[model samples]
Target: MTGPTGLGTRTITPDLARGLLLALIAVANAHLYLVERPIGYRGYPSGLTGADAVVAVVQMVLVDGRVFPLFAALVGYGVARLAERAPESVVRRRGIVLIGIGALHGLLLFPGDIIGAYGLVILLTAPALATSSSRGLLAMSGAIGVFVVLLSSGASGPQGVPTVPSIAAPTLGAFLAGHPGEWLVTTLFSALLTAPAVLVGVVIGRSRTLDEPAAHRGRLAVWAAGGLVAGVALGLPLALAVVGVWSPTGTVGGVVAAAHAAGGYAGALGLLGLMGLLGSVSWPGRGLLAAAGTWSMTLYLSQSVVFVAVLAVWAGGLGSSASLVTATLIGLATWLVGVVVAGLLARAGHRGPFELLVRRLTYPRARTSDR
Candidate 1:
């Protein structure tokens, strides 16, 4: 058990899982800066060639719309873990810090940043975090299920004109150049999309299931299997569209989109389950990943920083026409750098820079050495 603000006894599984998830997220996001193709679902390119086509196909099946939810779940897990021991004010401070960071991240780096969404979710779900595990679980499950049902049933939310960011040489420059109103709209949409997953994550955190994966093998396995199946089933149609196998239109398209979105939750749960199982055994790269995962918050922002520096139109400008294979390689390289940085930090017994920053912000009264 960890103290509210303490990093506590670091669990190998969540860190390892998060490290892996970060790589997956890298692969998923690597192509977003490429302005050559039309934006499609999950940011998949509409046009593809040779190995790029193959990469796109594989990403659709396994990567896109998958890692975010898993990451969100981890967010909830972290919040719940802290909430179980820390004061509500402390947790709220953490949430506020995240929101501030996320807003800055969006304004300066990636427009599609999920950090802001996660922060909002934490703030919104603070009250529920204090409830008993059963009650929290019920509320989480009910809200998610109801939202999914509504979307799949073809109901609509408030209608607004879809806003698309323009292609600009410096991608960061483009985000900066975009209208503030449009950015806010997109950011709000992103936060709404991420709310359910974060709530579910909080439920997972509250249960402490990941703390002892060996004891939860059966439960983890079942969740993994069921989640994989449900996710694939719901997401198949959308995946088909992504890879050029099918095109969905009108209300049917909307329903498929909803199912695909809901499928992300299942996919994330399944991945978490798999990670829990892997933690039960000593797996290769586990050490490296665990190290990286520990620095997840810092590294997450670091990824965007690196992306902007290397691929932005005004920067490296390498992403405008990068093939899927090329982008994937770049993403992998980025994640590898994170692994190295994390290893170094772990050896020094230091938190990742941003991680420490947030900790300090959240607990200003706590000693600097506390984290």
Candidate 2:
């Protein structure tokens, strides 16, 4: 299960599964950045067209709120993995770094910045959830997530896209100074919204269900099927209903704006099931994805920067009033650009630049001047 450097103890299947989770978003975001760019899906307009529309339609049908939850779940699973590898004290310290990163990440929430919110979730929730049993924590987290989605629905009337920074001002300064109770609200938001995914990770870590794919294929098949039906049935209407309905004001409206966000969550789980099936049993691209997933934190942050640069008004200006289809094509091109760049970098034995920085910070030392 572990990677080659003895650094990866993650079960290969689960690692691959989690890797798949991160990549799933690339599909949609590529479109947003390169094609039919949306301001937000929470309550605002999602202006899709052609391929952008097609991707959106498919995402609405499949992956919507679902991916983040999966990401969160994997964090939970990873937390478990960390605890097993080190003392609680060491783990807690690591947890703080994750939180710090997340806090910083949240500040970076602009059209260009992604995965910052995810950093927030790992920081805020993992410490508390770490104490509970996998199943118990997941159940608790899922219930809370459901509550947030439902509660948000009745309040704001419509919300914007969760991942896209439609309502959120595009700068760290804005989130800090402009938004009232931004810290408290965002912290609370991350906690309730992300608990299930983190918990799901814990459950998977605890159950060791994913590691032995061959042994559990039958169970996975059943769960995947069940997830497909339930996820779609619940996610579709809610997502479509909220189209062009979001407004970026007040707590209630924000919650309602998260309907599409909720659907995204459901779709993420369904996708996990789908991807797990494909990657675990028979994926030609598993090695590449696995490699990318191995250095995930590095790759993730890099993607954000790379994506923005590619889509920015200055660089390629692909973000210039393109339809969903056009944007998707742009996104596809951008993705190829990223994959090739990442692959070449990986081949050179360079982990993500960020990953190297974190490693240095986590374990610093003085040079032996005397020697």
Candidate 3:
């Protein structure tokens, strides 16, 4: 079931979840690159209308905060699996490489790069992740979750002002100069925000929940049902406000935003549970999705590349001109292209270039045949 060498046997649930996550990430990030707009909750533009409004609402509830936590969970799951086989040094080396790659990606393409944040988490928590008991991990997750909720309360800003000034930087030079500082802030914030999900993922991986979904069907079902319902319910108020339907201000708005942010963890778990259930059954296009998952790191970086080219103010200038609807269409197109390219690579028996790079760098002396 394992891959030719270093990678563990690919499982259906995690791979499928990762493949699906990229699409959500694409749509979630497209609007954040927008410029000359008054930012609102979660960096969405204020005063949306028509289809733009609809898209914003949908993304707010289902995609925005949800995807990143899921991505964090997947990374943690992989870390847990790697820790089972590789030495601690190898795991830390992988984290270091990710940080380097993430810095380059953030500086050159998108300032919202998450790889570095996850790398930071891995670097700091490697020992704890490998040794923590279930109860201990859950306790840490709860503590961090409280902190994240508090952090998210201040996430809202005055509706008519730009929240992230760097996103609207006027010139390429200014954008590049401002990005490293922004990336530092974002990496720290992301690491804290996603810590709980990562710990939860380690718990799930330790239990082999997705690896043997059929044996844990009952638990997965509860997670799927409860998590999804809670996520949508908690996210609704923010979605409404973002789409110009509700106008909660003052403390009420802050509470709503915090609740919405908290819902992201539930949504991530819900989606993982749903994927685990799905993994128990055979379906069409599963291979394609798994292939995309195999190349997820490469595809994720490629998304930023495409977005910067198409939407950055200093590039195509579409960030200032494209409607939310158009940007969403572009996101979907980008994901589709990634899927096709990933499938071709799979068919050709080639690993993703980035995957190869990481493998080579992490295991410097390992032979290609062995790894």
Which candidate number has the best lDDT? 3
| Per-model TM-score versus the true fold | 0.90, 0.75, 0.94
Regarding lDDT, does 1 or 3 come out ahead? 3
Model 3 lDDT, residue 359, Cα? 76
Q: 263-370, model 2: which lDDT tens digit per residue? A: 556655666666566655765767665555656666555555655565544455555555555555654554455555664565455566655555445434422111
- For each candidate in turn, give its C-alpha RMSD to the true structure in angstroms: 3.3, 5.8, 2.2
Stretches of candidate 1 off by over 4 Å are: 1-8, 148-174, 179-183
lDDT of 3 by residue, 1-371 (tens): 12224334567678777888888989988888776777776677878899999888788777878888989988888887877777778778878988888898888878788999998888888888667797898899999999899888886544564434566777889889888888889888899988888888888888999888889999999988988888888899989888778787789988998899888998888878888888777788877887788889999999988887888877777988889899999999999999888967765677888888877787787764323
Tally clashing residue pairs in candidate 2.
Answer: 39
Using lDDT as the measure, what is the rank order of every candidate, best first? 3, 1, 2
* lDDT assessment of candidate 3: 0.82
Error of 3 at 173 (Å): 1.4
- The residue-by-residue lDDT of candidate 1 on 1-371, one tens digit each, is 23324445678888888888888888877777665556555565665667877787677656766788788888878887778778777777778888888888777777677887788777877777776565656576668656754654352221121123432344455657663554466566666666677777776766678888898899899988988788878878777776666667778878877777777777878888888888878867788788788788788888888876776667777767777788899998999998887867765677787887887787686664635
Assess the local accuracy of residue 174 in candidate 2 as a C-alpha lDDT between 0 and 100.
47
In model 1, state the lDDT of residue 287.
82
